[model samples]
Target: MGKNVNFTLLTMLYLFIYIVASPNSTIDKNALLAFKAQITSNPNKILAKNWSQETPFCNWIWIGITCGKRHQRVRGLNLANMGLGGIIAKEIDGLSFLRSLIISENSFYGFFPDEMGNLSQLQEIEM
Candidate 1:
C-alpha cells in the first residue's frame, strides 16, 4: 500500500511539472502581440492595463482572456457586451490557436478577415 501511494504521488508530481514546463511556455511573444494588435483600440482604454507575457496574462485578470491551466496558452477570449464600434481586422488573423471569441452587441460592421479561416482551432465564436 505504501509503495502504491508513493508511485501515485510521483506520477502526480511528474504530470504537474510536465504541464507547467511545456514548449508552449515559449509561445511566440510576437504572435501574442500580433493578436493583441488586432483588437480595436479603445479611446476609453477598456483592455489590458498590465497585459504582457512577463506579467502573466492569466494573472493580470485581462477582461477577455482565458489561459489554459495546463499549457498556459490562451484558451479563449470572451469580450461580450462591451460597447464599442469597429470591425475585426486582419491583425487577428494570425492567431491560429484562438478557441473562442465572444464580442457581441456592438456597432462593428465590415468584413471579417478571410485569414480567420486560418484559425482552425476556434471552437466557440461570437461577434
Candidate 2:
C-alpha cells in the first residue's frame, strides 16, 4: 500500500511540473488577434482569412510569423510591404518572446505603443 502511494505521489509531482512548465500559447494568440483587430485594411486578405482561434499561432509561419522551436512562443513577425494599414496595438507587448517585428512599407498610423518597451527579448523592429 505504501509503495503504491509513493508511486502515485511521484506521478502527481511530474504532472504538476509539466503543467507549470508548459507554454501558454493563448497569450501569444490573443496578442496576435489584438494586432489583427486594429487592422483597417488587408488588401491581400491574408490576416482576414487566417489568424483565427481555430488554428494555432505556430502554424502561421507561412503568413510571416515565426515561433520558437522549444516553447512555441512567437519569435518574429515579418509583414513588410503587405499593404496592411492599421494602428499598432499596445497589446503587442504581450508577445514577450518576440525578437523581430517588421512592418515597413505599410500604412500603419498612430504613435508606437509604449508597451513595446516591455519586450525584453526584442532584437529588431522595422517601421
Report how far off residue 56 is in candidate 2 (Å): 0.5
Backbone Cα, N, C clashes tallied per candidate: 0, 0
Pairs that collide, model 1:
none
The stretch of ten residues in a row with the least summed lDDT in candidate 1 is 22-31
The sequence of per-residue lDDT tens digits that candidate 1 reaches over residues 1-127 is 9999999999999998767755544452345555556657554556545346565555535567787765566777776776656667565644556788777775566887787787788888777
Instruction: Kindly list the per-residue Cα lDDT of model 2 for residues 20-123, writing each as its tens digit.
Output: 63546777888999999999999999998877778877865348789998777899999999999999999998899999999999999999899999999999
Judged by lDDT, which candidate is best? 2
State every prediction's TM-score relative to the real structure: 0.62, 0.82
Q: Report the lDDT of model 2 for residue 62.
A: 41
Model 2: which residue pairs collide? none
> What is the TM-score of candidate 2?
0.82
TM-score attained by model 1:
0.62
